[model samples]
Target chain A: MEKTQIEELVAKYNEGVADPKEIKWIEQLIESGEIDLTQLRELSGLDEQIQKMEVLSPSLNLDDRFYAALANEEKQIKKGTSFSMPSLSFLLPRLAMAAALILSGFGVGYFLQSPAQKSEVSELSQEVNDLKEMMMLSLLEKESATQRLKAVSLTSEMSQASEKVTNALFVALNQDDNVNVRLAALEALKPYVGKSSVRMKLIESIEAQYSPLVQIALAELMVSIHEKKSVNALRQLLENESMPKEVKTKISESIDVLI
Target chain B: MEALSDNALMMKVKEDDLGKMSLLFDRYKRPLYGFFYGLNKEQELSEDLVQNTFLRILKYRHLFHGEGDFRAWMFHIARNVNNDHHRKKRVKATEDLDNWQERIGHHENQSNEMQHNEEHNMLSMAMDRLPEDKREVLLLSKFEEKKYSEIGEVLGCTEGAVKVKVFRALQELKVIYKQLEKSH
Candidate 1:
């Protein structure tokens, strides 16, 4: 196509008139350089010139600044500073642990003094008070992780930095043995779950979380995306009558809400 | 992390290396300024946005995690800074029109040949005519040196879809240029 001919095709495409065949021809010509649409290239260059005139022509290059920024960022890393990870929350109650030791020290003195919370303790333990505490801890941890994840999408500048955090989280999510830990990691990852690369990995882990609780969580997340294609994927599980009832129920509910 | 990456610089900034942070600021200040100047044609505001982008970069340095493509990330930040400034100031529609006359006047005395470069002026005038999203895609792809696929990733579209948008954008340019030619 000549310059004007290519321009005409573009014009038609712009007007929504060019058929697929004409579009293909235009693409092929531009790609192969069969027709010298030098005029069009020059036109493209005009935008480039104005851009250069505005943005690039003014500054020194970016290399030195990047190096300086890196130097500052890495100082602590180079200093061999090691951050101690916080102690895990699943430890036994400290007061009970203390009381057992203190039982030997003197008369059997109870830990003291809140009679009201104490009265309800017997009933609560039978309801598995420890498990409730653990669940509460998990919920707190989930909230904390969620807050951390939110900073990722909060600004465009942090994109590269966020990706790094995502990479680290992915490794933790995949390899961590504790289902609760993995669940926490998944919650931290929920905001970034839409990226195809991340979504695929999340999908792969759904089956491995054989616990019904985890499956329900994953199923709800699975169909939450606005994309219909994701809903269809969950619908596949819904169609499988032999699939676990809990997973199907979760997916079916999500599909209903999403669709 | 690669030595030259923004993540590496962010690490340095975290270490309290003011000198490195300064260099990074200096490095980005111009391109960032140019980015704003391309749109607003106001050097002072461009400089202010450039400085503010660096300040925000520094403020958020501790938040750094290594990621792909730092330059694009920085540009995204700069883009937001410009928008934020626009929001705070609220340039009225007529003010932008006034700007066109003043901005065009900056080069009015140039040779006839330079004036005849309809392609150059047409782009700005055409982009000014476009909806905001269309103009954004063109600027990012053409001026920022971002690949079409990368632009799609940034804009949340497929590369093929971005290609379609670019085609329309250029057609808009041609039509506006033709109209200008007719008016003369």
Candidate 2:
């Protein structure tokens, strides 16, 4: 069709007198991009009104739900990306560099030491031990039973513990709230039990324990170490009216063995 | 600086900067809601479909290669969510006629309450009367700002095809609007 014919067809449609066949032709024109929706007057008015129609704004509940879901999605994405294994190609060079640095450090420390430097190194070692002792004491004071257990376990790493360290272990064995930490403290004190002061403290601690597990453990340790003086503390424990019968029987047997 | 484009924000979301989704949601929520509300005419359900569209966007963010318009991709998901809801509702509708009647009555009450202006009320009533496919095309034309090519992307057709769809929908709408005006 010529441009004039298409124009006349659109005019007739706009004037609302188009027959069914003419409307079909106009639909074909629209599909062919010959006539725009805007050129058809009545439909354009309706389209404009549809566009201008007011839509109610979504409530704050929608915002809350959307942001909540987005936050959950973000959390999942973070969890997915947080622990991806590094490719071997990316890790190999850094690993080689770190190994080389460690080897060089050992070589330098072994070769460069003299008498004065040895003394300085020994002093540095002493300062580190002091820091560890302070850290252990402070950690034993922590509220978390796991932290106090960690503090007691730190003593196993030391070749020689200071008096303050042993005192902290004694405090933990007698007064710590968690039985596991107290048990750990008892095990940690075992290595130092050869010292008379540590042995005396252990014997004293025998009377302070209320838990049957700790009481049985202390009684077993006393019998293992053959501490004859703990017989009095064991007898005192036997005198406690509230002590379980099994524990009193165990302590009585330990006292008889010591005698 | 100008705000990031929807495609830019979506690409960032694709790259695992998931917070960027909030920006896209803010930009499109109202228009998306309007599109759903135009078709469903229930405010809460429309809002829910809008949220489902964004949720799907986040879920499939990795698949968005940033080659196409973000709004078009969103409407594609919105159409699926709407269709899924209606599909499930259709099954339930067969099981319960009383519930369907109650819903119809509720929709009428909701439309009456929401349509404060008389002309807009008549137009909204006419829109509700339209068949789903025709109503969808008109709502897309309105909310998408008549970007026929992008609407075509959403509907899986050509720009010319989208224009024809808009024309047909509007022609029917005109007849319905005239009937509504006379009855009112």
Give the top-scoring candidate (TM-score): 2
Alpha-carbon TM-score of each model against the true structure: 0.41, 0.57
Q: Which ten residues in a row have the lowest lDDT in candidate 2 chain A?
A: A75-84
- Residue B23 shift from truth in candidate 2, angstroms: 0.5
lDDT (Cα, tens digit) per residue for candidate 1, span B1-184: 5445565676776666656666566556666665665566554456567766776776676665556445666766777888898786555544566667654565453333233433456545555666666667667775456476666656667666666666556656666767877876
DockQ of 1: 0.15
All candidates: CA RMSD in angstroms?
Answer: 17.2, 21.6
TM-score, prediction 1: 0.41
Candidate 1 local lDDT, A162-195, one digit each (tens): 4545665555455555556556667767877668
lDDT of 2 at B128: 85
How far in Å is the alpha carbon of A197 misplaced in model 1? 54
lDDT of each: 0.59, 0.88
lDDT of 1 at A151: 35
